[model samples]
Target: MEPAADASAQSTAERGRLLFHAGLCAGCHTAEDGAPLAGGRPIESPYGTFYASNITPDPEHGIGGWSDEDFVRALSEGVSPDGEHYYPAFPYTAFTKLTREDMLAIKAYIDDVEPVAQPNREHDLVWYADWRWPLGLWKALFFEPGTFQPVPERGDAWNRGAYLSEAAAHCAECHSPRNLFGAIIDDVRYAGADAGVEGGSTPNITPSKDQGIGSWTQDMLAFYLEIGMDPDGDFAGGAMAHVIDVGTGKLSAEDRDAIAEYILSLPPIER
Candidate 1:
């Protein structure tokens, strides 16, 4: 039997909530103790430090005055509220894979949220790094849109895993290495990453026996996702711990399992 409209709407909203956490939107956007989407957090990077902009419903600083298209452009196109190019540090590249409906739900949830009047912080960058147009062109060359492509032969759980990794969770954005211009080197896949809060390397997550988690049990992977603790009792430090504490911690157990299943299926690359 078909579900009722109210039930469907509730389900959609609940899914929107799930996606928000799975995507780790609040982890970077808001101060650790602040409200959702209020957007006054700092993002440290090798290129330069950036501050998260206000995403609340405030007309001035937040996105309260934004139209549907405006929100869509910012998320999928990496364009700012005033049409300036946003740095890839915002992770719009990963968010680009969300379906229109999913994006709309997220936007709706943001609109329905309370607004905070926090001012944004400025970036500390070199001269050439200030160019926004170049970033736009770079996006044009590498960025692709629309939702995750489903493998028809894969089960629904596996497809869900793909969606989380490719779109919402955006594992590749961090785990994958980048080229000279900071664009992800797709050829390397998940070989490893050099970007971390303090200049440490993100370990290769491929199924490689030596360089990656080839020996990790499926249960351990799921547990790590939920708690950020490894089998050796080692907890992830720096920004990764932040991801675990906020993002993955909010995900459902089933969803975390899906991510593990999809990750286990990737090619085992020697790092």
Candidate 2:
């Protein structure tokens, strides 16, 4: 029984490992192959220069000392370990929908990994941008932290798709357009805009007869998300390619199908 327990623990650890990769947490958080969660990566944005903060298990610097509740607060509440509001650049706005279990899984994996002692990089924003204290107001205006709203009419599979799109995957973070303060303009969800790497706009995914991806069948969308290839043989480039390479590539066929279904169900707009 002891050995079985140990083996189960190891398996859970492995799941955490896979989840970290699937979530692409390292890409934005860590420098190339740097400590798993000790974030030092720089994110360039039109708003200002941003840096990914350390998320490792280091007690002082990383999340090493964070309790499960602290982890949940960070992901679900957008609060740091010491109750600081994180910028949307952290993408907790999208991550807010992740279930407590999923958040803990990510935390557990982080805990099992090595702790990097590197200090977090500071943001180089202009004075107006440096007013980090206003995030409370920003959250009130643009951020609403909550779990996913399940669609009762949808099947479990479709619900799973909703979870991926709304929570773990956070497809809208890039695909969706943002207001001046970087809050997503949900009214135009899935409408096209320049958001990929190099500031390229994502093609609309709504089922619009012309302006959106109405022409793409479920299989095609699934294939594109999986391998970055379309029926037209066009390979996704830039940030989209990175997403396929790291995040979507790790999803199961069923989950991918769920995403496709959820996307297809959206109203098509001719934007």
Candidate 3:
């Protein structure tokens, strides 16, 4: 029989699995009609097409050989075990805010998945993009590695919402406009942006009634996350539909409400 600690570890991994879904890792990593986390998804960008890496437990092709420190470094510092800098498309900028405990939980869950013997695909970058040394300069200019800090004045729910939205869910990566360098424009956060998945537009999620989601009640937003059904009788489609299917739709009721509360509390922005 397995030891008590083994059972406890299994329970922690299960919680991690749910958190992984909430974080939308599978949505980005899984290719179209492909095995989950086997990773052949082609993410389009202004620079070129970048493929997501295989994160399964195959030692030769995936993260099976990675230590916990290796995993944390990849997420927190955007550095690989061999000291290669990862491209910004990985969203390590947002992931850098995750706590060590949360990072380990995510790793534990990933370790529990079945190993796939698929090799990682190379990126189809623009001309003269073969070199990775330039990423170091980019990181120096834009990347800020730190954990999420809760405001002492805010209540637990508000802080939790902030952590989940900013760090785990990385909502702004899609919702905010980016500069030429592909860095998010901090000033216009949640105010909507172009260059969404497959060239679609990401709508304003701010609290402006004229342009954003201020017309939505907290319940309405929560319901949308839970089932992708808006108050207007519209259902989410496209990339958002996929997000709802694999990510927000799987969150707990309290978490969905907390996310809505945090988003609705944002100052209105007239995008």
Candidate 4:
């Protein structure tokens, strides 16, 4: 019989499976018609086309050899086991806010998944971008490694929303504009961005009366996330539609409401 601790670990891993869906990890790591977590999805960026890495348990080609500490470092510090710097394209900057417990849970869940024997693809980069050493400098300038810190003055729901949006879900990766170095502009977060999504621009999710989602009620936002339906009865399309299907749609009603509440609490931005 399985030990009690082992059974508890399994249950925790199951919860982490849901967290993985909410984090949209599968969306980026899964290639078109490819085995899930086998990777090879081409993410286009200003600098180059980055192929997502395989996260399966394949010993030769995936993260099967990674320790829990190794996985945590990769997610929170953007550093691989071999000390290589991961490009910001992986969004580890935002992932840095995840707690160690959540990170371990994610690792446990990944361990439970079937291994795929797919090899990783090299990134297609612009000229003069062959070296990865520059990423260290980038991290120095913009990255702040830490877990999400709740504001003491905020309510539990608001804090939960902040944690989910800023850390777990990394919503700013798509909605916020980036600078020349591909760093998000902190001052104008969630105001909208181009080139963040494939083929089309990411829309403003801020609360500005114009251009942003200020007119949207918290309930409306929650409904949209849960079902991809707008207040006008129209269904969402494109990448957002997929996000709803794979990510937010899996969230519990309480979590969805918390996300909405936190989003609505942000200062309004017009652009």
Candidate 5:
């Protein structure tokens, strides 16, 4: 019985670790040479530069003192412990689809990690973008907080892949173009973006031959994800390299294959 208890604890920790990587928490939360999850990294955008917030267990600077409800609200509703609104740059938009179990697992992992006393840097938004009240209207316009529901028509692997892509990896967050109002342009999702996080170009992963990864096979895409090398032998650079290193590369082969399968299944849209 004791061994079973220990195994349960270990599996939870391990699942949290994988989910953290799959969720790409470290990609934004960890700065170069900074403490893990201490978050001082700045993400470039058309609106303004948004600094990543500290997510460590530090009581003062991190979420150490936050209640479980606070954490859920923060991620699901884009609200903070103090009832403040979070900018869309945090990608809570994607996280809102996460299950309560997975969310708490992430919290468990975070709570057990080494605490760092790092304060969050304020977002440097354009003057008009500084207000948070308008966010309520924005939420009403676009936000729909819900957990992922499996598709009965699809198999378990496909459902898992969809969950990972939409709720976990949030590939569309960068890959899709955004409207002037900061909402994703659903019509052109996965059709590549001129400006993404850190103001970098994101490639289309749809199966479009000319405009997307249509030519790539599942094996090719999975290998690229595992090693950060494109079909042309060019290596991914900048933010993508970081994501591969800290996120997808650390994922299991099966998970990587699932992502590939899901990506390849998308309808190709030429831009």
Candidate 6:
């Protein structure tokens, strides 16, 4: 019985590990030369530089003591264990689309990390940013917390791709340009950001020939996800390079194909 239980746990953790990579948890939680998931990565935003928190298994500094409900609430609603609303910088807006099973799987993977006692760095935001209670209002206006629902007429591959891109990889979070309010502009969804993270532009991936990846074949896109080399002989650089290095590059070929399929299906928006 003990051996069987151990196998089951290992299986579950493996599934969770897949989810973690797909979700790019390590890309955000792990800093340069820092302990994995021990946090301290600085995210430069228009407001200020927000630091990622320690997510290791440490009972004192990490989420080691978090219950299932706590984990779910943190991702699904961007709420903290103490009932405070977390800043949107954590990308809970995209994570809200994750299924409960996937969320638990990610937690399972996170559970395997050795506990680290490092403390989290505070965000260097505008003076008014520390008031997290107002974030509830931000959520009310712009946030819609829900799980990914497959489009009925789509094939399994397309649906699977949708889940990976929308819920797991969160492609739109960086690809789409946001309004001054920090909410994504619906009209230009996937139409590229003029000035994105680190003040660099994120490309339009909506299949527009004039501006997006319309000229690229699906195979080309999938291969790019695998090796970071686009069809034009140019290589992806900057933050995208990091994403491919730790996130999408580690995905299964089938998953990469699915992502390519779903991305090509978006409305072609010429930015």
Q: For candidate 1, which ten residues in a row score worst on lDDT?
A: 194-203
- Model 1 score (lDDT): 0.82
> What count of clashes does model 4 give?
0
For model 6, which pairs clash?
none
- 258 Cα displacement, candidate 3 (Å): 1.0
User: Which lDDT tens digits does candidate 2 get at residues 1-271?
Assistant: 6999989878777766656665678667776677766887777666667878888778778877888998899889888867788888777887888777778778888887788788988898777888879999999988888988898988998898888887877777777777787777888878766654335677788888678888899989998889999879999987778788777887778778888998888877654
- TM-score of each prediction: 0.93, 0.90, 0.96, 0.96, 0.97, 0.96
Q: For residues 1-271, what per-residue lDDT tens digits would candidate 5 score against the true structure?
A: 6999989888888888888999999999998899999999989999899999999999999999999999989888899999988888988899998898888888888999899998889889999999999998999998889998988998877888888899989999999999888989999998988988798889888999998998999989889889999999999998889989999999999999998888899999988
Query: CA lDDT of each candidate?
Result: 0.82, 0.79, 0.89, 0.90, 0.90, 0.90
Write down the worst ten-residue block by lDDT for model 2. Answer: 192-201
Order of the predicted models by TM-score, top scorer first: 5, 6, 4, 3, 1, 2
Error of 4 at 258 (Å): 0.8
lDDT of 6: 0.90
**Regions of candidate 2 where Cα sits further than 4 Å from its true position:** 1-19, 33-35, 195-198
Candidate No. with top TM-score = 5
Q: On residues 191-252, what C-alpha lDDT tens digit does candidate 3 reach at each position?
A: 88888765688999999989999999999999999999999999999989989999999988
* Candidate 1 RMSD computed on C-alpha atoms after optimal superposition onto the true structure: 2.3
Put down candidate 6 lDDT per residue, 81-190, tens digits, no spaces: 99989988888998999999889989988988899999999888887776777788989999999999998999999999999998888889889999887888989988
Give lDDT tens digits, candidate 1, residues 1-271: 3569878877778888888888888777887687777776777777777777788888887888899888888778788768898888888999888887788788766766788877677777668787777886787788776666899999999999989998998888888888878888887787788775335678888878888988887778889999999989999887788888878888899999999988878888774
